[model samples]
Target: MTDAESPANGSGVGAVRSHLESTISGTLESRNAGAFVHAGSRHDPTVRYCRVALGRRWPRERGREVVAVAFDGDEWLTASSDDASGHPAETLAVRLAERSGSNTILTPAAVPHDAALYLERAGLDLASTDVVARARATKTTAERDRIADAQAAASAGIRRAASLLADAAIDDGRLAADGDPITPNRLRTTIDEAIVSAGAFPAGTTVVNPDPEHAPSTLDGEGTANDGDTSEVPLRPGEPIVLETAPRGPDGYHAGLVRTLVVDSDGGRERRAHVGATQSFRSAAAMLTADAESVTSVEADLEAEVRAFGFGEGDDVRTRAFGVGLEPCERPFEGGDRIDPGSVVRLESAVHVDDGSWLRIADLLVSSEDGERAAYLEAPSRSLEPSALLE
Candidate 1:
């Protein structure tokens, strides 16, 4: 890599959205969306593909999903409108499609009911497929670098957690620092502050409450750390501490990470779960190449690794992995979809050892086209030991 592209010397930040970065872009694939109108809010299932269809980023207001763009195979037509009475975006989209000599709207069946009425009233046929989502999942060079930057920021947060845990003391079978017991809330705050210090914004659910000593698992609502006082419990000694977070960079791209740690270990379930989790982590990551087949394959491999470690796939609560980018978990590779280069996916490997106790290790990975290797975006160590994490 050239010095100009080095992460330290040149931080490539702007790859997606800016300013009201909350205000994002509206886009739908025109390649296969021919003779169809593509319109939906960010809340739609297809809404996850809204920002990637066209090419670059545009502006989307916080609440209104009122932008529609259509390509008639020759020229481009763009229109946007807002109203309380009906779906103005859909109205404009259908009108533009008809103007382009087409009377059909190609959209996922998951589009909002109000928006669906616009196309149905126009007597246009609705195609029940998410062609826009299937069109492409590749990120440009700048976008990849931007995501890597966000991963770096997330790594900073993990480092902060590790540093704090390393400095804490085990007192009366509990983690303590500065004469006070180290709580999940304190660790989460430390991690979020580290992410912010590294020029990234912690999401509403940034740092999930880590697993304590006796009671291991505390994963809530896919990790809603900012929700209740679940993170107020003091950490236990010699148990798995799950430090998982997804933080967004200035460019509106997000990165995810999960690493477990055990303090003052007595070499019990913590060691066993960590060993299996680490192996599963590497095994799943190895399948993130451009030619990778499906997410199920990776998930199966991870499950096997943990199961081989003499653990059962804990009931309904288990581990999972998927694609990560603008949204924390977007464009999942389920349903036998092919992996494309330039796609960033997060493989979160969790091992449920017993009731209320689990161990997990996760990382952000970028696919490579050359078959050479996929690269990890975050640079934090996945050591289950605090001293190793300090390294």
Candidate 2:
């Protein structure tokens, strides 16, 4: 490794702060923003882009990952939480934009007020153009690959969930493994282990809910509402268990996968709902495009597809698709933003059954440059039967 990228050098922020010469025209242009400023912790996309895209690294002691960063598409200035250089990370970050060729800085609303004041004090214009947000919504090929790798790990976690369900035996109507009633904590630990083994961090969250309709919502991929819900309720046979996991890859990209399975099913209402959810996934895959104008329209079609299968949609249970990447839900094109050609999305298809639960499946999806149709990054059976994952 080069000296700057090496962790042993203790170069701290200087290693990452480069004054590269680029064809930035050294003059303002009506094109993409010539300068961008962002501030967030390591999980933020700014750090990811700096680390992954720009091939930069922070010193080991200075690698706290939380930082205020500024860039002009080529040059970079950053200050981390570990900065002892007597310079405030936020102020240093905002000050660098003045040196950039651009007269204005494109920053999101999340900018720190103190740092923002630096721009104003320096007499530089501040444009709330969402430069970072826009770039994050549009994934480069490498970003998509990282997200897919994370999703593959996420899929492994879901597979582990299914394998556990398959191995559990019905003991007095409750799912049992090793003669102990399997609990949500056990399931979460197992799934998280599988995810880590597959080369991703389970930092996002792993949710194991026996009943999604009544369980706290996982619509945001955090499952924060159901922190310990249904922990005491032993999963019963014929009951549906929802496993939703969002794992971030080593490089800061993230992906989500959710699956619902039943142990020792009776082949009744649950089966129908499972089929409806699975079919909706297949149908949506057949229609998605890389440049879909309105993702909401595509989501509406999946809702209709689920309704056609004799399953009723519940107000609490939603069937939809949204962008996924640097965050579990990067949320692209939802607010009239154009769909990025290489963006990754999560397709969630769900149907509510009379059994007081909602059956659902979610997987990472992507469309090719051909713009014909989208497809799943990983293929696992959506069957309600636990053994389907093994198939």
Which candidate has the highest lDDT of all? 2
Residue lDDT tens for model 2, 248-294: 87666778888888787778876766777777877776666634645
Provide the lowest-lDDT 10-residue window in model 2. 1-10
> In model 2, what lDDT does residue 67 have?
68
* Local accuracy of candidate 1 as per-residue lDDT tens digits, 1-391: 1101112212222332221121211222343434434555543323333344333233433455455544444443445454434555565555665664445456566655666677677766567654445432445566677678888888888888888888888788888888988877788888899988898878754554344432322344234422434566679876677788888766566788887877777787767767777777676667665366576776777778777887764532256657776667766667465556767778766665544556778887777767768877757778777778657
After superposing candidate 1, which stretches have Cα over 4 Å from the reference?
1-33, 42-65, 82-87, 210-229, 288-290, 310-319
Give, for candidate 1, the lowest lDDT window spanning 10 residues.
Answer: 1-10
Count clashes in each candidate, considering only residues at least 3 apart in sequence or on different chains: 0, 0
Q: Assess every candidate by TM-score.
A: 0.78, 0.82
**Which candidate leads the pack in TM-score?**
2
